[model samples]
Target: MSTPTLLTGRDPRSESALLLLSAASGAADAFVFICVGQVFAGVMTGNLVLLGASAAGVGEHGVALRVINALVSYSFGVMCCAWMSERLRWPLPVMLLIEVALLATGAVLWALDLITSDGDRLGLLVLIAVAMGIQGRIRATPTNYFTGTLTSLVSRVTLRSRDQGDSWVAGRLIAVVAGAAVTALSVRFWPGAAAMAAVVPAAGALLVESVPRRTSRG
Candidate 1:
């Protein structure tokens, strides 16, 4: 067995934030896939395949453009957040607040019924994609940014402050599924709240990260 990191160094708040973040990712992807467009917001691999199919004229070209819009906006968000966080010294809470703003914008648009037209679809796609990209860029140990994709998550389960365990991985999967499930139900029954699925969880993550951890002397 690998040497365990000090358990005292762990903060349950951080783990809760991670689970909420994972749920946010899952909810965002699900809403974008269903409501915004048929393409994924964060799952770039799936979008790439859809893009190729569009180029081959397998489906409507408009779908291709939507995929491209998501890809571009997602990249832009990743680059900007990376620069500000790594180079500009922006804090994690501030970074998460930015993401929350983006998610909130998307949710408001949906709740306001502003995304009905064909042109509005692209904008919605960009908003969700950018938010997802920013969520992916958050800097925190044990947060598992890799939760964006389950396929690769199982292969790499290293935690910076805790020993690897089944609960570690299972918790993330369940969080993701729970997020997706909530979004799916909302989209099915309460379509107006489709994008709100991610917004609330994202806000929760931001709040969790914003709080100062309590200290105790050993």
Candidate 2:
């Protein structure tokens, strides 16, 4: 018997499925880098402190600016997803494109020293927030770190491994760890460029696997 050849097309259902998987994997990796960077740069905790200080009327304008920027950035990220869902049958490619565009934009901003010395801190925050927001929402399964919080990821892993008793828990936990390792290595070697490099595979995956005819085959 002859082996059947796999034919591909940009079908909406096939495209959507592949895109979702790409988004999930990309988001998983991005989460690791974002979390690590936030922890290292004192961004996440600082946001909380800023919130507290703002509530107490002792907050600096910078805090509020940063907060607003963060909100806007995240909103834009979510909007990217929404835009895809609304305009395209397969929203994954759009999401990947948006992510790549954002990364490129960030690179331009960085090259122009827009986020280095005396840079627009608010703008930078917004960019980071949006990127993180998109990643945080993409997940194959949720256990911990729903928003890139490693602490929660760890705790949930422990709980799920024991309670649900699923065999895949170990593999998922390993993925998280591996992701962290990649982030660390990338950051060490390429610094900010590491983040930009991550978007490549994500985009490629969507482009390669989004064969539209898969949905129609069955």
Best by lDDT: 1
Would you list the C-alpha lDDT of every candidate in the order shown? 0.76, 0.45
Candidate 2 Cα errors over 4 Å, as ranges? 1-50, 53-64, 87-90, 111-114, 134-177, 213-218
Query: Which residues of candidate 1, in runs, are more than 4 Å off?
Result: 1-11, 139-165, 216-218
Ten residues in sequence with the least summed lDDT for candidate 2: 1-10
Per-residue CA lDDT of model 1 for 1-218, tens digit only, reads: 33212112145676677778878888988888888778888777778999999988887648888888988988888898888776777777887888889889989998999888878988888888887777666634333234343444545554333344445556767877788899999988999998898989889988977877687899
Candidate 2 has which clashing residue pairs, if any? Answer: 9-212, 10-212, 11-212
The alpha-carbon deviation from the true structure for residue 111 of candidate 1, after best TM-score superposition, in angstroms, is: 0.5
Q: Please report the TM-score between candidate 2 and the true structure.
A: 0.53
Which digits, one per residue and each the tens of the lDDT, describe model 2 over residues 1-218? 33222112134333333333333333334432353222111124455665667777774444555555555666676676555454444344455456556645664564465564323544554554665455433333432232443445567777774433222434434544554555556567756554444445445544654444333455
Q: How many backbone collisions does model 1 have?
A: 0
